[model samples]
Target: METTLTLKDVTITYDKKPALEQVSLSFPKNRITAVIGPSGCGKTTLLRAMNRMLEEEPGAAVEGQILLNGDDVQKLPPEELRRRVGLVFQTPAPFPFSIYKNMTFALRYYGVQNKERLDAVVREKLTLAGLYEEVKDRLDKSALKLSGGQQQRLCI
Candidate 1:
C-alpha cells in the first residue's frame, strides 16, 4: 500500500557526460517492475544512483533525489542506506565461505547474534531466493562447490 522506492528528477553524470537524465519513477511495495532498454541506456546507472552507489565512482555525480521508504537515501549514511536497498548484480559472486556462512555473514554484519534468529533468517532468505531446496542439506559445504547457476541463485 506504500511506495518502497521513489526517484524524482534523478540525473547522473560521469566526467561531465550524462548517464541518466531527469528520470522519475516509483516502486510500490511488494510489486515487481522491470527496466528494459538497450545496453548503456542508463538502466544500471539509474539503479546505482538509487542507493548512492554512484558516489563511489571517481568522476560520477548525481543530482536530484532518491527516496527509500519516504527518506531521501542520498541524505542517509551510506552503510545504513545500503542495508535497505541491497543490490544483487547480474553475475553471481559467492563468498569463499561455506553455504551457511555466506548468508550468516550478512546477518552478522547487521548485528544479528541470536542463533535461532540467524538460522531462521538464513533459511527464510535462501528460500525466498529460490535456493533453499538445493542447498539445504549442504549448509556447511563451500559455496564455490555449487554450479555457477546454483551459486548465482544462492547469491540472490
Candidate 2:
C-alpha cells in the first residue's frame, strides 16, 4: 500500500506538558484510518499534529515531522494546508452567530463572499451532512440553538 501521510518521530506538548511522544506512523492512501485509544492517550494530539492544528493552541509544541505526500507540512502554507487536511473534532463547538453565519464564516477567510455563492455552498454542505431539511427553514436562527447532533453536523 502507498502511504498518503507519514509521521516521523512526532511529538507534541502543551505548555511543557507532554501530549504525545516520539511517535512514528504511516497512513496508506485510499484507506479509512482510525486512531482509537482511551481518554488522555493523545489521539487528538496526533490528529492535530498531522495538519499543524496544534499551532492554534497556546504554548503548544511539535517536534519531528509530518509529511503529506512526501512534502514536509512545515513547508506548506498554513491556510492551504488546513484546507487540504481538515479536522472536525468529536465535540461540537458552534459559534454564537446564526447557523448561516457559522457556515459562511468558515468559508469567508477563504475568499467566499458573494451571498449567492455562500448560500449555495452552505446548502450544499448542510445537505450533504443530512442537516439541510431539518434546519433549512431556520438557517438564520442561532447556531447555538441546535441539538448536540445537529450542532456537531453543522460544525462539520
Report the number of the highest-TM-score candidate. 2
Tens digits of per-residue lDDT for model 1, 7-39 = 899888999898888888899999987888998
Please count the clashing residue pairs in each candidate, in the order shown: 0, 0
Give the root-mean-square deviation of each candidate in angstroms: 2.0, 1.9
How much is the lDDT of residue 98 in candidate 1? 98
lDDT of each: 0.88, 0.91
Clashes of 1: 0
Candidate number of the best lDDT: 2
Clash pairs for candidate 1:
none
The ten-residue window of minimal lDDT in model 1 covers 83-92
- The residue-by-residue lDDT of candidate 2 on 30-146, one tens digit each, is 998999999989998899888888888899999999999999999999988888898878888999999999999977977888999999999999999999999999999999999
State the number of backbone clashes in model 2.
0
Those runs of model 2 whose alpha carbons end farther than 4 Å from true positions after fitting are 15-17
